[model samples]
Target: MDHREIIQILNEKKKICLLIDASKYATILTNDSFKFEECLRIISKLTSDLRIINKILNKKSPKDKITSLTNILLQLYGCMLALTNGDVSQENSNDKNNIESNSIKFVKGKYGKPLLESSMPIKFSMTTDKLFSSMFLTKGLEDTEVGIDVANVINYCGSNCIDLFRDIFTEQEFNYLSTSPNATTELQKARLFTKYWSFKESYSKYTGEGLNCAFQKVNFGELTIEDDTTIKTYDLHDDIGLVLNFYSKWIDSNRVLTVCYKCSNDHKDNYIVHKRIDLRDVLNYLNGADIFD
Candidate 1:
């Protein structure tokens, strides 16, 4: 669907007041024409917050390094846009930069979880799979860390990967998957596999370690509250805690959207979670378009 259509759906749902256009990530990464100069131009238009970009650009000693540097900038910018209530525009300034700067610095914690600078009022984390990206935005209601992940279920089903990751599953999870009288064995395996992957990615992102930590070290199982859901937690080094929530919805008969979120108890009831594909409606509103229009 086009951007406008996506925005309409989001507006109708009213689950969130912010929208981040991540649709450009895949395009920018895969396209050869996406040069550093073009990327800089896009960044300039995307945020009036120049201080961060200046810091990034100034650190590169070689001028030629700007092209590769843009990738890092885009990832950070994408995360910021996804988490905050803001818009991409040429006329804005870095007034909000201080607020972001205080809360968004990245550092490594025990087991190498990427830690946010402790001073920020909120924390956010995310993970992206082939075609989809998921982000969790949390205000530090009480010093909570949060992360999210999304993936396509169809891809995991085709590779016999579920069995390969069986060691990561708790005994209950293994028995449930193996013994369930589900319709087709392949379909059942795919569902279980997607849950594990989504939950694992979410947990890893929560700790800021990403894929650096081994998945087998974490234990996961299906929760009784939801028939098709799975939850997992990690006991990483330091006092860092990890929790994952997994769910899947079919995009088509052959494709599914698997999403997972990671968070600590401090984040309870302090944020709203939403998923949307369109951004133009929010863009229009941010630009002062009449809602009635």
Candidate 2:
């Protein structure tokens, strides 16, 4: 969506979503002159958090780490800028009226969920998988909590997914996967696993625990697989929270998306709405970053 459209959507929807295609930077990442330290420094300017800077530096692979990080930085930069002002280009623009982009930061919470390192009542979560990542930002009202997650279907299914699922899901969940309407074949079960994994990840994010450790412990509570990909109902135990709403879709057969959010039970079903978006402003702005330096 365009900048104005995003602003309108956030103003109306109370939530902003961004999906970033990070493949364009792979070549630059491979270049010999690409400086990991410097590129992170640039991202840090946007994040303004040493936790974000130090956390990303701890990644095992330099190229993979930086590219994954760029996804978060670029998406966060765009949404935050767009929400604050209609134009993102003005960060470096000659026009004096254009406000400089605010100094933002990304730091993990106690549960490993990414949180905005600011006093402002804003909550956001980010997820990265291979060449893609998503960000969801919401108004952190006192009564509601927001969390989102994205998963790679093909990648998850490529591994020993059955065993992995056994370890990650509850016994009932494993039983459901074993007898799902579309689980006659191994591939179907793998895709089924994707939905569960994505949801659990999102749930943990919403609770600010990042799956509360391996997702096996965070129960999704009686989810039924409608067919192959769609989860019929994503219910949480009443003891966990007052009200929970889920928004999920398959970006494609190979990728599954999910957003699990909680709000005060007093609010109706429409309280926090999520809309998938590819904010063009974010990409355009990150394209000029000097990662190759």
True-structure lDDT of candidate 1: 0.44
Candidate 2 on 139-173: residue-level lDDT in tens?
53545667677776666555366675577888777
Which of the numbered candidates is closest to the native, going by highest lDDT? 2
Error of 1 at 104 (Å): 6.7
Tell me the deviation in Å of residue 284 in model 1: 10
Question: Distance from true position, residue 32, model 1, in Å?
Answer: 7.8
Give a tens-digit lDDT track for model 1, residues 1-293. Answer: 23232223223322222223334443443344344344444445444556546754675433223323333343344334334433223333222454344444556567654444544344455444433334444433334455555545566645446466677666766676665555245766676566556666666665566767466566554532123333333343333344444444443343333344443453323334344533233323222242223
TM-score of each: 0.55, 0.74
Pairs that clash in candidate 2: 47-104, 47-105
Question: Where does candidate 2 have its weakest 10-residue lDDT segment?
Answer: 91-100
